[model samples]
Target: MNLSVSLASGEPIYQQIKEQIKRQILSGELREGELLPSIRHLAADLNISVITTKRAYDELEQEGLVASVAGKGTFVTEKNKEAIREVKLRQLEEQVRSLAAESRMLGLSKQDVIGLFDLFFGEGRH
Candidate 1:
């Protein structure tokens, strides 16, 4: 697992690490059943505190993305494609809801937001 913590980012370092690792897992870059580096090793690699790495791993475990075995190490959990898709869909929906709220706060109509989305994504499709 590769992670680069952005100290300049407003997000907590552990959250940044957790998000990157989660993205890797979702993208299939980090295969299921693959062992992740030890928390100490990962902390040293990222030049962060062990507590930060532990927090990231704890969140992953809570999300069922990784499992830890006593005396062994943390490993990615095997997930069905449908299950992964559902998880991703839920996450996306939450983000979309937040964005919609922000748009509403900015006085953007639903149609205007849809148009902006189409313009932004449609351009990339072609």
Candidate 2:
């Protein structure tokens, strides 16, 4: 999986790494059982400390999104994929619900919301 860390962002590097990896898994870009880069290697690649990458992986494991073997490296857990999917789906629904509430408060019509979605979701600048 491709990953990058932004030094300019106020968020912690470990959190940025964790969130991106989670997004990739939830979006089906990172398949189940896929092997992730070693923590040291990932830290080197991102120019961050090994502790940061390790923290990110540890958090993922704690959430049951990834598994680590004694002699092997970290890999995505097939068994927990569905659970992760459900969690991600619920998070997305909550975000959409919040947006809908805000739109209503702003007096935006359904068509206005649809237009905003189309404008942002459609093919354009990446």
Candidate 3:
């Protein structure tokens, strides 16, 4: 797994790790049942504290996106079907909300804004 954490980022290291891992899982970059790096390994790779990596993994397990097994390492959960759908929907909602605010500031009508959405989404199907 490729992971990076920016010390200069405004977000905390644990949060950055958590969000990036979540994004990777949601984007299908990390397959279901895929084994994650050991917490110590990941911490060494990122040059961060083991507790930070553990915190991120803890959050992922709580979100049902991953699971920890006895003696074995952490693995991406196979039960993410509904969780994935919800995550994608929330992402779409945030995108639409930002676009709506931008469109309003640009003095676009509702129909015009929706048409723009159709244009964007329609092209994405190709």
Candidate 4:
């Protein structure tokens, strides 16, 4: 899986790693049973500590998104479709909440938000 970290993003490095990996799994970019990079190797590649990568993988395991095979590396797990859907829905809800707050700060109405959304959502359709 492709991953990157941004020190300026204000999120912890492990969280950035965990979230990208989760998104890849949820979107099927990382398939079930695909082996993730070894912790040390990934850490070296990202120029971060192995401990950070291990923590990210641990969080993923706790979320049931990946499994460790002892001697082997971590791999993606077969997910429950409903659970993935719920996760995505929650993410969308959070994005909408942020958008709503930002729009209110800019004095934009609900209709204004909908109009902007429609404009962007339809940009590629046409």
Which number leads on TM-score? Answer: 3
Instruction: Give a tens-digit lDDT track for model 1, residues 1-126.
Output: 678988998999999999999999999999999999999999999899999999999999988899999999999999767868987999999999999999999999999999999889867564
Would you estimate the TM-scores of all the predictions? 0.76, 0.77, 0.91, 0.83
Locate the minimum summed-lDDT window of 10 residues in model 1. Answer: 117-126
The ten-residue window of minimal lDDT in model 2 covers 79-88
lDDT of 4: 0.94
Model 4 lDDT per residue over 1-115, tens place: 6899999999999999999999999989999999999999999999999999999999999988999999998999888788788888999999999999999999999999999
* Candidate whose lDDT is highest: 4
Q: Evaluate residue 31 in candidate 4 and report its C-alpha lDDT on the 0 to 100 scale.
A: 94
Q: Is candidate 1 or candidate 4 better by TM-score?
A: 4
lDDT of each prediction vs. the true structure? 0.92, 0.91, 0.91, 0.94
Give one digit per residue, the lDDT tens place, for model 2 in 1-126.
899888889999999999999888877898889999999999999989999999999999998889998779999888565787688789989999999999999999999999999988967776
Ranking by lDDT: 4, 1, 2, 3
lDDT of 1: 0.92
lDDT of 3 by residue, 1-126 (tens): 788989998899999998999999888899999999999999999999999999999999998999999789999999658878987899899998998899899999999987886887777574
- Give every collision pair in model 1: none
